[model samples]
Each structure stands twice: as C-alpha cells, then as structure tokens.
Target: MRTLAGYTNIMSAKPGDTVEFKVSSHGPSATFSARLVRLITTEEHPRTAGLIERDVDAAFNGEYPARRQPIHTGSYGYVEHATAFSGLEDFTFQTWLWPTLLGSRRQTIAGTWDESRSLGFALEIDEAGRLTFLMGDGQGTVSTANLPTPLVERQWVFVAASYSAKDRTVVLHQSPRCDIGDLGSAETRKFDIAAVQGKSGQRHFFIAAHKASASDGLLLAGGHYNGKIDSPKLHAGALSIEEMASLASGAAVERLNECVSAAWDFSIDQGSDVFKDVSGNGLDGRLVNMPARAMKGYNWTGQFHDWRTAPHEYGAIHFHDDDLYDAGWSTDFAFTIPSGLESGVYAARLDAQDASPAYVIFFVRPPKGQATSDVVYLASTATYMAYANQTLIARDPLDEMSMGSLLVFGEDDVFLDENPEYGKSLYDLHTDGSGVCYSSRLRPILNMSPNAKYWSFGDGYLTGWLDALGIKADVITDEDLHNEGESILAPYRVVLTGCHPEYVSLAMWDALKTHLGRGGRLMYLGGNGFYWRTAFHPTLPGLIEVRRAEDGSRAWSAEAGEYFMSTTGEYGGMWRRQDRTPNQLVGIGFCAQGFMTGSYYQWSSGSSDPRVDFVFKGVNKGSKFGDYGLSGNGAAGQELDRYDPGLGSPRHAVVIATSIGHTDNMVLAKEEFGAMHWMIGGTENKNVRSDIVFFETSGGGAVFSVGSISWPMSLPIDNYQNDVSHVTLNVLERFRDPKPFSLPQ
Candidate 1:
C-alpha cells in the first residue's frame, strides 16, 4: 500500500489558471509539505543526467493538514422523488434484466430500500443468485420472498414485484426470455400478510443498487448489480400476473397509463448522465460513476447494430460494481501558475515524514494566443489517460506469455491489486469481464510518476535531452491541440511528439494535418502513433473514451453492435479502419511489437537520397547507428512502425533506415495478416521492422519520422553523444531553419 498518494484536478493549465491537488496520506503524520518542481527526465541510467528536477518557489509550498479520502466505486441511477411514493397503498415494479455475474452479495435491480434504515421495497437478486422481492417497514421488520430457481448468468430475464394493501398480499414474478426447459420456466409467488407498509421517507429511488446512506451530500450505495437493465417501470397500483406478463412481453402499458408512476428509458439521453422518464411523472434520474451506455438492450435484433439508428432496440444501461469515473477527493492545496512562467511539465511534490514522496504530474502551456518558443512538444496526454492505473502486470493472465518473460510487479502494481476502486485503464476489463471503454484523470495515477516505466515518463527523456542542449521549446498537451486545433501550432515552426502516442483524437489528427499543410514541420519521434480513434468528452475535461472496434492489437474487443462511443457518438476503433492510416501523415504505420528487447536501425538504400542528406550530415557512415540504448538495449524495438506504399505511405517518402536483427518474440501486428502462422514472427517475416522516413508535404511542410518508440530512449546513451542523438539533432536543426523545401518530382 502507498503511504502517500494523490492526483490533480487538471493535467494541463495555462498561466493564471489554478491547478488543484488532492492528496491522501496513510502515514502516522497528519501533515505533509507541498512544493513545485519543474520535471525533466527521471531516468537513472548511468549515461544520463539522473533525477533532474529544478525547484520553483511557490506561495503554497508549506505544510498542510492531510486527511484520508476514500473512493466509492460502482455505477447506478437514482431519482430524488420520494414524495411520489409517500403513503402509497399499492405498488408494482418491473424491469428487463440481463445478469452478467452473480456472487454471494445481493444485487439490486430497482429499489427505494435503504439498507441502513431498512425501509421501502426493492426487487433484487438474493445472495444465492435467486430472484427475490424485499420489503422493509422502517420499524426493523424486513420481509423477503424468494423464487426457488437461481438466475443463469448472461441470460435475459423479466422480473416484477407487486404489493396490494387492499388484499394484504405481496407477489413476485420471474420469467426467462430464452429456452431452458424447466429451470427457466416462468414463476409466480404470493405471500399473505396482515399489513404492508408503503410510507418510508427515503428521498432517492435507485436502479442497479440500493442506498446504504446519504450523509453530508455524499451517497453510499450497496448491492451493486453487474449487468444490463432495460425499461424499468414503477406503478402506483398492484399489477396482476397477466398485466406484468403483458408488459414484459412487449405489450403496451399505455391502456393502464393512469397507474404509471415512473418508466425510465435509458436510451433517451445516450450521451449524457441523465436518464429520462417516459411515463411523464418527471421522475428522471442521474447516473453515478459513469456506467456503460450505448449498450444493446434486451429487445435488440440483428436488423440494426448502432444505437443511434435503433435506439429502442438499444435501451439497456450496463452497470458494473467496479465502475469509477472520479475519486471526488477534496482539494488539499492549489497552485496558480504565475504569469510569464515557461510552458513545460510541472508536478506537485508531496512529502510526509514517514512516507514515500508523491509527485502529481501536470503540463503547462503558453498563455492563450502566445508563443514562447519557435518549437513545441505535443505531449501525448490522451495516451497517458488511456493507460492510467493499468493493471496488466497484475491482472492480465497472458501478460507474462506476451512479454516472453516473467512479469515484474512494482509497488504501484501491488497497490492497484489491493485497491481496485482506483479504477482501471482502457486496456483492462471491468469486474464483469467487459472492456473498459472510458478513462479519467480525476484519480491518482501511479504510472504517470516521473520515475515510473513507460507511459508519460517515457517522454521525459526527450525533454531532458532538449534541456541539456539549451534548446528553448514550449510544451502543449493533447487536450490543448484538440480544443484549439491548428491555431495552437500555427505560431511554432516545428512540432515534436513523444514516444508511444498511440491514441489519437479526431480533432488532434485534423490539427496535425492542417499544421503540415501550412508550411509547418513535424518530427514524429514515436511508434504506433495515430492508430486508435479516440474521443474526448464534449463537456467533461480530463476524460477520454476509446472503443476497440474491429481489431488491431487490443486487450479486449468491444461488442459487435457497440463499436460507437457514447461520449461523442462517433465510431470507435483503429484509424486505419476509417482509411486514415498513420502512414498517410507520418510516412509509417504500426507494424510489430516486442517487449524488454529492441534492435537497431540499418542504413537503407534511400540514405543516399540528396533530399535527406541534411539528416545525416554529422553522423558517422556506419551501416547501423542505434545498436545500443537504455530501453530494450537498442533503439528500434518495443512497438515499431514501417513505411508501406500499400497503406498510404507517400510515394515520394524516402525510407532512409530500417531496423534489423529482432528476436522471434517480436511478432507482426495482427492487422498485417488475415491468417495466423509461424512465419509471422520477426525471425521469419520481413515486414516486422521499423523504418526512418522523410517526405515533403504541400505548402513547403515536411515530415520526419523515426518509427520506433525506443528512438528517444537512445538519446541519453553515452551521455547524449550517441549516433541517435546526433541524427535527431541534425533533423531538428534543419527543420528549425526557415528554408522551404521544394516537392520532389
């Protein structure tokens, strides 16, 4: 467990903007000190500058009281309409449910029952996974009626419960939508009672969970259900067995509309957290913790796949007990960026006397419409958010096999294993085995640490190298480029990218394309970039969504009809699937991947091309230049990209170098082949290689791509005197020049 952990509300800010930090401390000391630091590279390689962080004095740099803020996990919908059910004499609740997983814990389908107060009624699945109807009198008397058969996982079922004060009876009904012979047959149970209480002052009615407590504006929920719930209806009078069966079987309930109290249609607001009530009682509710929307409901058929086309068929809302969107932690301290502060990477350094110090990373951009330098580094913050708090090392069963070595667990991995409430990356699966499509930066992310491996920290090497070379470059995040478009980059002559910028939003893509079209230069120093189609929430900051549609190196595949993101209602998947392959912009696209080992790039035939002669001006005439490095022992391993004419690689693009000598573990990407075979491995396949390419665009713009994630990792080798560093510097110097390049005939 971590003694000190925290996160910032915003990942990037401009001058005069305040960034809030929320810290959680479990140490014996209740006080912690906060200081501001300019982050360079934290790589500990002996050949590199180690642990370089320049301290910046700040007004908020002092001791502050620390408190433990717990995270509540789970997603549900709740409506604050208790007056609708106050002093009710009769009632009925019905819903279409598709259970995914059931454990010893009870799962509420719909309820007003408060577990602590033991009040109201709820339709639920009991601890044994059987359908049950529960009622509480608020005076300590709780009653439950259960069906004999247990529910089958991953199957659709219709359930209903009713109470009649006139008859002093309670009734429950369960019916499966599929064929299961006797076990899946319809069931109805009735219980005789002297009296049934209908008045409990619980303010909120919940779906997929029941209230445990609501104190000080904080809601504590229990009995979180994992699965889909559709077309939930509540009535003011008891519904007969025939009436309930008619409602569940798609018969219209409008004939008896006078008794209708609330009917929630999840498909109404597919992109927002609000659920609309179709029954006209104004009993609308808001979803908590960001449940999965745009799901295929019970009535879905093969006719239409997208929810936008057939919303009625896709009314379901999939809720998971482990769904977490925000930590909701209170701010411990906030620092407003002082005017004229250089735009770059910064972090809040928090320290407790007996605990490990924590660094919450954030980026600072130049003031609006201002340019601090002629060059800019576009930080891949989208990719960082997509991989925040990932647990592939601890939870992925095939992780060791994929890496060709035993997985190593760090302190962060252990902490994530113990506390899943911190949420997971898009690469991970939810508790119910569904792909996690949404990610947020509102919670602590251990992998974003300056000292952590890969992810955001991997880019620090380039920044550190630039600092050492006395180059003045401004920094902007993915969000800034996305929100402002090409205007943000129009002021800079050159743009640089970090390693592993795998996630690309449509806005960011358009901006980069526009930049290249307007005589600007781009240095794509990374691999597997602009591959996945990503979306940022239109109204929510620091949140991103990605759906793994139709394949291309994925941890989990989205459902067939669920390839569209609920955030922007855009199709989610690889950019290549939409005919926008990365090769179209950078002269290369993702080709292959391997872990913990890398290879070197050999001079290709195009090295003699006079157009790219400036790229190798001061470099040695060696056949290969990136033979040694810190990451994977070489500069051309990990995930690699290659120039391919068949996949939109510009015909005039020069392939100056190609990586060679990779182990068999480095296999070709799945998208490269339709059939699986042993020949696809790096040892047998010629396609599994990285290529260094250069091409000139219209308007005198140009692109220089080093198609390897390990390219920057080789910069600090030999104290930044290596061939990789020299070649990169050569390109940077020429790109920084104002000379316009003529298109090759």
Candidate 2:
C-alpha cells in the first residue's frame, strides 16, 4: 500500500492560474520533499522512453511536514435548521424504503439522533438488521422498541416509529408493500418503557444516516443505509397505526393537513441537491455525496421512463454507504503557473522518507489568446474522470474472464482494494448493485497515477512520441473544450486526440464539429472516440455524469426510468443511440474489443487511393506492419473501431488498413446485433477488426483515424523508427501544411 497520496484541486489550468494540491500521509508529522516535473511518458516499458519526465524549477521545491486527512464516505439528506423537529414530546416518523442490504451492519433510516451525545430519537435498523425505535435522554438513559422480524433485502417496506409521552409507550410498524407470506411478518411491535425520558435535542435530522459530529456547517455521519428511500414524513402527534398506515398507503398529505409536520417529497427537484418538504412548514434539506437520484418510486408505473415526464413516479433516491463525492481535504500546498510556461502535462512529485515517490498530475494550458503552437493535443480528461479510481479488476470476477488472464495487482491496486472511500468509477457498481452514474475528481484517483497502467498514463506515450518527433503542441483538456468551445481550437490548425477519447459531452462535440466545419484538421489517433454521451456538473469542477442506457458493452445498465443524466438532464447513452455515431465525426466507430494479445494491420485496397497517397508516402506496400510494440505486443489491440457507411461513415471515406489475427475473445459490441449468436467473436465475425480510415469534410478540413486504442502505443517501438511511428509522422507533417484538402469528384 502507498504511504503517501495526493490530488489536485483542478485537472486543467491556464498558465497564469493557481492550482492547489491536497496531500495526505499515513503517519502524521511525516516529512516529504516536493518538486515540479513535466511528464512525457509514465510507463517503464523496455521498448519505449521509460518513465520520462523533465525537472522544472519551482519555489515550493523543499521539504514540508505531512498530515493525514480522513475521507468520510456516505450519501444522505440533511436538514441543518431542523428547529421544527426539536423538543417533540409526542411524534411519529414514517417512510417508504427499499432495502438493498441487511444483517451486516446497523443502517439508519430517518433520525434526529446524535451519536456523540445520544440525545435524540432515531428509527434505525438494529445491529441484528431488525427495525427498531431508539431514543436517548440527554442524561444517560436509553430505550428501544425492537421488531421481531428482520427486514428483507431488496424488498420494499413501509415503516413507522411513534412515541407517546402520555404513557412512555413506543410503537414500531414494519409493513411490506407486498405480502411477506413466509419470510417474516411484524405488522406492529408495541412496548412500554420504564424510566425513559424520551427527550429530543436540538440535533439536526437526517435521512439515511445520523450525525456523529459537526463543525463549520459540515457533518460527519455514520450508519449509512444502502437502499432507496421515498416519501418520508413526520407528524406532530403520536399517530395511531391506522393513521401511519394511511400515510404509507399513498394518502394525500392535504387529507391529513392537521397532523402533517413535514412531508418530504423527493420528486420536487430531480436535478438539484436540495429536496422540498411540501407540508408548508418550509423545511428543506440538501443531499450530500450525490446519491443516485431519479430512482423509480414504489408507485412507479410502466407508462413513463423519464423523470421529466412523470417525476412523481421517480420520487425515490438510492443512497449507498460507499458513495463519495469529495474527499474534502485541506490544501497542503499550492503553485501558481509561471509566466511563459509551455502547455503540457505536469505533475507535482512528492517523496516521503519511507515510501515511493508519488505524482499528482495536472494539465497546464496556454494563456487565453496565447497559442504557443499550430498543433494542439486534446487531453481526454472527461474519460479520465469517468475511469477514476476504478476497482473493477479487484472487485469483479467477470473482469478476469474478460481479460482472459489472471488479474494482476500492484501496490496501488491493493491500496484501492483496502480503501473504497476514495470513490468509484463509472464502470463500477454501487454496494447496492446499481451502476455508478457520477464520478468526481475531488479525491485521490489511484488508477490515474502517473505511472499506473491506465488510460491516462497510456496516452502519455503519445506525448513522449511528440517530443521525440520534435513537435511542439499546446495541451488542452475536455473541460476546456466544453467550456470554451471552438475558440479554444481556433488558434490551432491541427488537433490530435488521445488513444481513447471515449466520453464526450454536448459542448465538446459541438466544438469539434464546428472545428471541422471551419477547415480544422483532426488526427483522430484513437479508438472508441466520441462514444458515450457525458455531462459535466454545471456548478462543480472535476465532476462528470454518465449513464449506461439500454444497450452497450457496459459493466452495468442504468435502470429503466433513469437513463437521463442528473447533471444536465440530457439522455445518457452511446452517441450512436442519439444518431451522432462516431463514424459521422471521425469516419469510424467502436466495433470490437479484446484484452488479450494484439494483432497487426494489413494494407487494404483503399491504401492505393490517390487521396491518401500522402498517408502512405514513406511506408512500404507490405501486407503487414505494426505487429510489435508495448501494448499487447502490437498496434491494433484493445478496443477497436471500424468504418461503416451505414452507421454514418462518410461515403467518401477510405479504409487504409484493417487489423487481423485477433483472438476469439475480441467480440462485436452489443449494439451490433439484435440478439447474441455465434457470429460475434473475432474468429467468426468479420466485423471484429479495426479499420484505419481517412476522409475529407465539406470545408478544407480532413480526418485521419486509427481505430484502435493501442495504435499510439506502437509509436516507441524500435526507438520510434517503427512503421506505426512513420505513418503517424507522415499524417502529422501533411496535416501541418497550409494547403487545403480538396474533394475528389
């Protein structure tokens, strides 16, 4: 496990901008050294410029004391100003819950309890996973009314807890939405307590969790439940069983106006964090850690699949015990980008006395209107955020099978396995088995470590290759393109993408399309480019949302009625489903994928096309090249894409090369077929291959695509003298020329 770790406040910044670094150490008072570096390649491959980074002088390059910062992981709703719920002598709390987990740990249902003082009432699942009504007097005494039957997992249950000061009596009700014929039944559990004060304090109320402590308007809570909660209500009086049943049976709040204290309708704000208490008491609360919203409520019908259409049916919010939106760490140090700092990938190198050196990576962009070079490298920051802190290889068994090899675990992977509070990737499932739709970079992401064998580090090979070819290019990220749009690309004549620009937002797409329309040349040196429809949080930096809707080669599928993103209210899925397939933009879309060894590409008939003569100028006319390199031993491996005119590939697009000799594990994407069949594996399906493509746009713009994620990895083979490097260099030099591309009639 790593002894030291850190993250940046922002991933991309301008030359004059300031960025903060948040660092943590396992041992308090530990000393560490820090410095700045411009990273070119982060991998230690023998065939490449291994672990290449240039030292950059900075003022903060000295020793400093380190401290450990804790991350509190959980999602819950909080009502900070809960004065209306204070000093209640006779009260009732009820809600509809769909429990996804039970029996392991105690789970809080709604409560005003403070664990530190033990001074309030709480409806919680006891240690034995049974519903219980617990109350504690500020002095010392505590009382509980426990139900005999433990709640069933993943089953909907309506529960109520009522207390009456008249007789010191407490009533707990657990009513399942459907008949619990054989599992267990506890329609009512009533008991009288002796010497129990049943006092309530000024402690705030919370849904799905209770407070452990509070400071600076921030809460530290525990006992987080994993499930869906909907239509939680509180009443002024200790309501009878029939009254609580009426509320649980979907009775209108107006009908019981006299007793209603707060009826929190979760359907009020689907996009925002705060929820509404519709009982007119003006009680509103905000959600912390960003739980899965727009969940199907208990009363959901099959009529509508969108929350915008039938919000009432999507009233539930699914809370996970492991949901982490932010680490909330204090910034340990900061650096202001110096004037005339070239645009590139940079990192703050940290070294502790007893640990390996750590690198917290960030991108430096050129100042506004200060384009340093004619070429720009568009970093896939959105995709990096989507894959941040991924734990699939360790947590999921299917991943090993998909890779066709036993999984390997490094120190970072082991650390992530032991520490899930760091956060999850879009490809991971929540503790409740629901797909994670939101990913934030406000925490340390182990997978994005500069030396880690993940997407971001793999893309570093291209940066190192550019340095070898003596190409000066400005660096910009997806966030910059999304926020600044086409103007960020207007200064650059040629734009080069990373190896897997998978997640794309609407603004990024529009900017790229606009760039192409204005005669901007794009070298799409990537596969699976412009695939998943993605969104950035409008108000929050370093956060993104993606939903795996209907069909895709996905780890988990979003629920039926939850295909829209809570970040932007846009439909979440592949761009193909939206009729904006990647082929329409780059002449190729994702078609096949494999994790085994890679294969080489063979020249196709279109290689002879006069339009692509410049692309093959210095390359031999042999059938096979790019058969060896770092990634899977070849250029065409990992996720592959193909040109299909039917899927919006331009009719004028030419296939320069096609990959061959893939293992059977390489299979066609799920969206390519109506149902599963034998003709889906690489051995059987002709479609399971990567196709190198080229095409021209209406303007002088043109696109050259290498439809394989591993294509760029082949650049450093034979010390950058390989065929893959030659072909890439050829295209870059031609695209750099001012001559406009002409349409061949």
The number of the candidate with the highest TM-score is 1
- State the lDDT of candidate 1 residue by residue for 549-609, as single tens digits: 9989999999989998888888999999999999998999999988858999889999999
Each candidate: RMSD to true structure?
1.6, 2.0
lDDT (Cα, tens digit) per residue for candidate 2, span 78-194: 886636767677878888889988887888998888888877878999878799887877678777778888888877788888888887888788888774463544487677855
- TM-score, candidate number 1: 0.98
C-alpha local distance difference test of each model: 0.88, 0.86
Whole-model alpha-carbon lDDT for candidate 2: 0.86
Runs in model 2 deviating more than 4 A are 27-29, 179-186, 194-201, 215-218, 250-256
